[model samples]
Target chain A: MRLGRRFVIAVPTLWLLLFFMVPFLVVLKISLAEPRIAIPPYSPLWEWVNGSLKFNINLENYSYMWEDSLYLNAYLSSIKIAAIATLLTLLAGYPMAYYIARSPEPRRSILLLLVVLPFWTSFLLRVYAWIGILKTNGILNAVLLWAGIIDEPLVIMQTDVAVYIGIVYTYLPFLILPLYANLVKLDDTLLEASRDLGASRMSSFFRITLPLSMPGIIAGSMLVFIPVLGEYVIPALLGGPDTLMIGKVLWNEYFSNRDWPVASAVAIVMLVIMMIPIMILRRAQARGAEI
Target chain B: MSEHILAAETKPWVKGTDRPFVRIKGITKMFGDLAAVKDVSLDIYRGELFCLLGGSGCGKSTLLRMLAGFETPTGGAIEIDGQDMTGVPANMRPTNMMFQSYALFPHMSVEKNVAYGLRREGVPKGEAMQRTADMLGLVKLDGFARRKPHQLSGGQQQRVALARALVKQPKLLLLDEPLGALDKKLREETQFELIRIQEELGVTFIVVTHDQEEAMTLSTRIGVMDAGRIVQVGEPREIYETPNSRFVADFIGSVNIFDGEVDVAAPDLMRVNTSEGPVMCEPVAGLTARQKLHIAVRPERIRLSRTPLEAANTMQGVVTEVAYMGNLSVYRVQLPNGQCLKVTAANGLHEDNPITWDETVHIGWSAAACRVLVK
Candidate 1:
């Protein structure tokens, strides 16, 4: 290759190698190091006290991770919450996407703009805005009390429901954009042909519209489900201690207990657990394209 | 009020046995401020192939859509088998449409697409399959039942669309520019195939097309539309030989038209005075004294000879150009007044001694061959 082309290609590759790959290798190395009481807990380096090479490495961290019941429970809970949230987002996004796709030309642009305008603000700030509304003393409770629907404030704060609401609100645009792309490409004449062929409007939707839009459904579910698996901020703020999410557990191990080896082990397992759906999503996307 | 007038006129025009199968009454459709079909009334009889012929944006497709119940008329009623279908949805109505694009289901097989309507009507699976197979056999697509739409050729796809529509046994079938997407040869072949199918099934068909030849070849009767209103409706021969107006004459076929003034109006015939010369026409309705009229003469009717013929209504002209097709020849003749008229002749023994271009020729037609078009 030419010198200029080599420079253009090699620069970002070198940057990634130094910044991204080096950090992951460092983490992996530290995860395999033995537990020792250094100034920074579980430092991989060993000191020669008796003038001999004092190298110590063990698989105790992996053994502990495998034996711990809490780690297993955290992984299972993460999957369940992400699955439920993905389903909820799909239920909410599908109709909104269809309506946007079916709206008049002038109104379709405005509706799509409104669906995406929430992204102008910071994602963390948006989640915080939801916090203000979903908390026990938030707008939801204030409205219920003012309307005399409830005598007391509802205990919505620091619960899994609030966490789910926070996640769905933040990722709604992600779910809707994909579904809209698929729904808008559908030919309206197909529905008319179906009706002309003696199928009712409702039957046409199920047999034609719904099946043809499955690729969008799978795509939107993946977009919401994958990131929400490792969600920390929403659960940390909204979920009580009783909420034993994997992200929270990993966070506790790394910061409060200062157990670096155990934290690294949990991080590796979480990475592996997250890769399952990613692989499944990749397969679905390939099949969707083929269809 | 109009029905009484139509019925009163119908008694003398056509007998009771020739009653129309489908009657469209005063159907006017308006989209906001624009009128798509304006006070259109037509009678399509049983087992007759009819065509709504026009150019784009002429509301021919809109009229077909209204017949299929895809668009409801702003005023008027559509009746199939003597039953009103004013507010009926397309699914509930006994009418089917063969779309212009042949909107076959991309996911379903041919057999499944044909069986869709029967299944929707709650027919048992075995009966539906039998009917679907029968329909496939009728359309000559029996062996291709397992193929999806995309797997078939354009002509085959059109046949699948036809079979799917006919499987329901609708009272009336509406085809919106059928065979439009096929090649020229395929379109011609499909046109004949469609006519044969309609004949065999004895079903009423209303075909919409912008191609004048397709309409002329396929329709038993045709309604020529312009600017959202039908200008004239008649049998194919009448539409070609005797159009009601200049617009219908020019739209249906190529003709040599002469703008003239009525010189005389007799009981059986009318005389018109044109810049080229005076000509005679068969007497038609809606004529007034000294009114401006258009005279249409078909290219084939004007006989050309090298020598001046001793005949009535003869014109002396020079051959300007000659277009030679394999079996026929068209001579463009320019009269003394600088008016050009076309004369088409079939190649035969006369072609062995044909007239060359730029030769002086005499063109004449019989008086009964021309129609006085009141435009």
Candidate 2:
């Protein structure tokens, strides 16, 4: 019995140690080091000098990030974009989740399957496909132009709007799945009780269903917000030159400038910035369990 | 407000002077081809605690749901307080329901839950707060107003649900298995608490439960349903003592029933020839001499002794098994013809007079004690 219990506990511990803790420690060590023109491109933490041990820890990377306004602007812009994208996803996904949750048996399963069906394709390919549909000469513009809806080709191909579309389209399932799970577990009698207590349908939704589904909302928002904060691909591919994100800046520092230390510093700061919402999501989940 | 809408007197059902507070006329609900509630009609008077009693899936809950407007009747009309309820949504209706699961809002405090309806009605904050506090006090949850539903025990949550439902002062209060979630001890106590509150408030209540004992203790009138139809509806004593059908007699309590045909029918008595022997039953109106029927008798009414007593019905049987309860002892006596019967005898305080197992004994009852069920 003891051996079996230990084995069950050891599996997840070992998995996290190997995959998560080690990689994070590596990044932390690199963030504290100085850039060098070498194979690994960063100075080691310690070196043998004058037959004794000597330390070479650099705080210059972090100070450089603080001195420049580029990093601060990128972080703020990323938060703004991520917050707006999350709001849009919520507005679109809540109704879909409620519809699926309220739908009767086989139809409910079919709707849930449709929500997750887009995930079967490659994420990158799906984002790339958004480009094909949203560009100036793409299907959307062609159809709108043919229908006399627009006299000129709308410049929506390379913009923040296109980026929002890509993020919501890609991460929609994340929001819907959790919200559906939460809404499905919500007892129908609670809604009935609300209605029976003289609440209008809209009032019932706002009072009962919305408050009960807060855990799902916070969880999905954190899942989308943290990833979209340091997201490099969608903004880099679809956003114009004015669109500056921390992930793109980090990438440019690592590959173009060969500055692994500064890149690691930027990555660490992004992680710190994302931790606040993730902690909030965790507290919400804890409270949900109590409920 | 609800009192103004209600008619006068507590036992209005007995006088038959005022119109029924709730009139369900031929209400039927169908789920595809199967009918959950098929043409059920009943009248509930003001200040009456009526119970819809049935086994599971017998449509008692469905009938209550229809009254609450949770499920619209497919082919009938309901008139509550002299107004037609067709096309009236659950929110618009002047009825509130206490669900079996209690359905307390897990996110809100007890005070907030009780105040929710009044807030929706746009009551002033001070008035709503006063009413909410009064309701919480009525349900004996005055100190736990700020606690959420999960923070309290099951019984406390149930009280919160009741306070929330009653704070609206609805014309009709529908409860679906209110005590089904509680344990035996709490259920018995809550049953009387429920009665006290109903009588004090003088509101018409329709409670749905499968427990016959609960129905007997809580309701002024009980409607026994079977197969999506109400088989019988009457006062508790009337339903128990003079059931019109075999289903109601068997469903209500422990009963020993014997199938038989009427050999002779007289004004005061009827002789039934059963597989065991000829049994005596009370004469029921419209029962023919040769009509096939069943003789039903309660166990406590039957007498068991070493010698036969002077009664209209008597049978000789051997006591096969005996179960000694504290107050009463149950005897499983088998007749010579291979039929077993349950007979219970209360243990007298200073008596050692119980026929042992495997002994020849006689069971007899008066003709009036056994009912004659034709169908």
Candidate 3:
């Protein structure tokens, strides 16, 4: 039985090592090498010289990233944008998820289906559709003018606000799904017990419901924040030039500028920065399971 | 009002000077097409441990929820300490409920769970802490105050739930199968502890349970429920010995009911002409001749013997089955008329292998042991 259990776990561990760790090691090696104006676009970290191994390591790509404010600002802005979008998604998704969970059984499945309905369309196409709605003469502005709520068209496209709206809209289901799972499993008796113990409706919500659903909140936030941190399509289609993000910078560095080593260095730094929240999420999940 | 006072004086637990702590008048709760609790009126005295006993889906829990203010009655009113609670929410009502699952907050420590009610009431931290400590001590869980609910055993978690509900010292405490999660042994032990704690605190308790033994042992009074209506309300012994209907008699314990028509109705005795035999029972007022009725005799009340005894209420039967329980033996006797009667006898030390299967026996009971039910 123990051997079979070990074999079961070993298969997935071996697969992760080959598919994920090996590629990550390759990226790390490239990040330590210097960029070259050649076909491969980067120097090898080790070379054969006079029958002995010679090292050709370069710290210049990493140094250059620190020296340039553009890369630093891109990293900071990506973090900031992802954090704000995660907060917005949480604020919008909590009530939606709570209502869906509390809905009658027949209606609950339909509400959950509505939450995941956006996934039927391509994510890129959805972001593009937002462009038509958020543009100066778009559907939103046209509707406001037609309804006499505004006299002129509102300029919403190609801005940070538009980028935020796009990220929140696209990642909303990611946040709500986990939250709904947690909220639906909550015992209704707990709420009634809280009320029986003299807690008002709002107080009972804070004292019992909020604390119990913290795991879901953390899981949902990580789902949105991790992907939005490296979000490329939404910002590329809806953000203006001022919306500097690390994913966009990495794309420009590797595809447009052809600096593979620098781009690899940027990727390495992003992974290190994201490790904090990923570790926090694992710890929270473990604690939730323990409870 | 004077009549109410006079009636209250008759009850052992209720003094004539003290008013009913909870007065429910014709309260009915309907769910779409189903009436969960049909128009039920009951009066529970202060310091009385009243139990609502019924089978599953019998609306005992629904009545308890209505008393706790979780469910609004479709009609009538509930008065607690002379205050009308028709529209009052659960939080504002002077009642606390210990759930069947013992809904202790998993995230909170034992002390914190106990202090939650006082905190919601905006009590000062010092007093709340003191009271929480006192309540934990009362439940004998003071040593485990820092532990979370999951860290405790089922019985310990039950104590935490009890402490949390009682720390607020509400006018009434509602327990919905509070010992349902515990094992049989722990449940019996907790039943006594619950009664002790209830008496110590002097808080009116309304416990809902499906276990007849628990209700009999823990409650000062038991309200037996069937379908959606209360069938009888009295002390546990009265409910057990003198059930008003066949439903109550069959639900409370093992019984052999004889469906019959009233053959003779005298001022002193009544005779019921059952298919098996004519049953003589103690006279019940208002029972006329030819009226359809049932004669219910508890299993333990019937006497069994190998030889026929000349008795007023006796029948000859062959023992079909004998189940030897630890303290008692249950004998299923088959009569010549094809009717099966259940007889339970205590296993005395000298009566080993007493009356084996297929043995002819005489089954008898006193007239007072038989309860006549018209419903």
Candidate 4:
């Protein structure tokens, strides 16, 4: 029975190594592969001529990254945009989470369901809906003009601001759910104790509630951030050509220019940058788990 | 102005003489249609450890919450130190509550938890630290100040919670099953420790517990609650020895209770016609004649002997089972009238060893041994 149990566990372990671990090794090998712009539009694995083996290796792709200013700019812009989007999501979602968590049982379940219902619909459909709402002749500007609040339709869509809005709206549920889960499990007596100790409502929020919700906040921010770093679809749909995100640049390299090695380098650099916060968040979650 | 005051005039502080330290008057709490606490009035004097004893859903915790300002009374008021606290929030109330779960902040260390309330009050860092140290010492947890709540054992965590609640020094301290988390031996030890601390600080404590032994051991006075109302309130001895109602008699301890009619009533004693036969009971004052009453006799008060005794009252019974505890033996005896009587024999050096199972025995008790109860 024990050997059968061991086999049950080892099967999934072996499958993961083959599918996940082996593909990463392939990617690593391709990352070091030589890039030659030729007829087939691909690098040859080896050059075998006159029955002799020749190991041709170069660091040209990595050195090329150092000289490319656009790659650097794309990397910097992605970081800045992801940070702002995360901040906006946190500001908007924390209070909504608190309200949901503190609501009466019947209302709490209904509100949570409503928040999560958006996710069940197609992700592409939600972004497409945003486009109609945020365009120059969109619902927002049209309503404002009808109300006589605006003289003309304002240019609201296809801007960095539009990109930010798309990111925030897309990931708001991811941020709020974890925050609500953590806040609901919080000891309400601690708040009462703080008040009895002499803190006003506002002070208690900053001192107790905010600090204690750090782990959830970090988890939520990372969840929104990691995907937004590599996000190409929303930015492509909402941002102008000047947006200069790494995802857009990487897409241009792969499909438009057919430069796989540079695209792979961009992918690798983005993954590395994203891993920093993810590692920190995993550490935080581990600490919370210890508790 | 003081010189011009009349001789009949009293100072503002001296004006209130008879008000209780904490008074709850006509307070009612309703959850939808079910009344959790209904029009309950109580006066808890300063330095008194009052216990609200009841079974689950008895509304004891609700009353304690009202005193702590956590729950607003649907009607009437709660006052502490003669101040009206009807609309006051729990944080603003001059009271603190020790929750049944202890509810210690898991993220904070013992010192931090104890100092949290004082720091909220804008006390300086140095002063908060000093006071925190003092509180930790009061709970005998001075060395464990740096440890988190989960690091401490259950008993230590309980002490930490107690210190945290008492550090604020509120006018009243409400405890909801304060010792419920501890083991039996630790609970008993903490019960006496709680009394000693309360007496030393001279602070009023209103404890809510479903444990009868906890209430009896720690309370100067106990209020026994059933449903949402207080059924009776008296000292533990008074509640046990001379319970006014059958409910009180049955709730406080194990008793041999019988439904009976009051056949005769006198100043000192009364005769009751019980199913087991005619039994005489000691009369409690204010009982009238022909009252439908119940009679209670404690198991330990009855005596058993092998030889049949020539007495005014005796029951011929057979011992069905005998449980020999280390200190005492419990005998379940069946009488000729088809009633089971529980008799306890104290174990001392060869001290009154009880009869074995299936042995024929005669049981008797004095008239004063049983109490006449009116439900």
Residues A1-291, model 4: lDDT tens digits: 999999999999999999988876655545556665876454655678889976555556667887988889899999999999999999999999999999989999999999999889998999999999999989999899999998989886889989999999999999999999888988887776666665678887887788788889999888888899889988999888878799999899878988777777777778789889999999999988866
Residue pairs in clash, model 3:
none
Ranking by DockQ: 3, 2, 1, 4
lDDT (Cα) of model 4: 0.85
- Where model 2 places Cα greater than 4 Å from the true spot, the runs are B1-11
User: What TM-score does model 1 achieve against the real structure?
Assistant: 0.90
Write out the backbone clash pairs for model 2.
Answer: none
Query: How does each model score on TM-score?
Result: 0.90, 0.96, 0.95, 0.93
Q: In DockQ, how does model 3 score against the reference complex?
A: 0.89
Off by over 4 Å in 3: A1-18, B1-18, B266-268
As a whole number from 0 to 100, the lDDT of residue A7 in candidate 4 is 100
Name the TM-score of chain A in model 1: 0.89
Worst 10 residues of 1 chain A by lDDT: A38-47
Better of 1 and 4 by lDDT: 1
Docking class of 3: high
**Candidate 2: Cα lDDT at A42:** 92
Q: How big is the positional error of residue B312 in model 1, measured in Å on the Cα after superposition?
A: 2.6
Per-residue error for A267 in candidate 3, Å, reads 0.7
Among all candidates shown, the one with the greatest DockQ: 3
lDDT of 1 by residue, A1-291 (tens): 699999999999999999988887777777777655676678654568678877667678889987989988998899899899899999899999999999989999999999999978887887778778877889999999999999999887788888888878878888999999989988888899999878889999998889878888888888999888888887898777777788898899888988888888887778788788789878877866754
Candidate 4 wrong stretches, greater than 4 Å: A1-23, B1-18, B266-268, B284-290, B308-313, B351-353
Best candidate per lDDT, number? 3
Q: What TM-score against the true chain A does chain A of each candidate get?
A: 0.89, 0.97, 0.96, 0.92
Clashing pairs in 4: none
lDDT of 4 by residue, B1-375 (tens): 665464213222123355578888988999999999988888777777999999999999999888877777899888899899978887788888888888777778889988988888778999989998998888899799899888889999899889988988878888989999899999999999999889888788999999999999998789999889888887798899988888888998888887778777776677788788878877767777667788788898888889876544578899999998989888999988888988898877865554798999999887877887777
Q: What is the DockQ score of candidate 1, to 2 decimals?
A: 0.62
Better of 3 and 4 by TM-score: 3
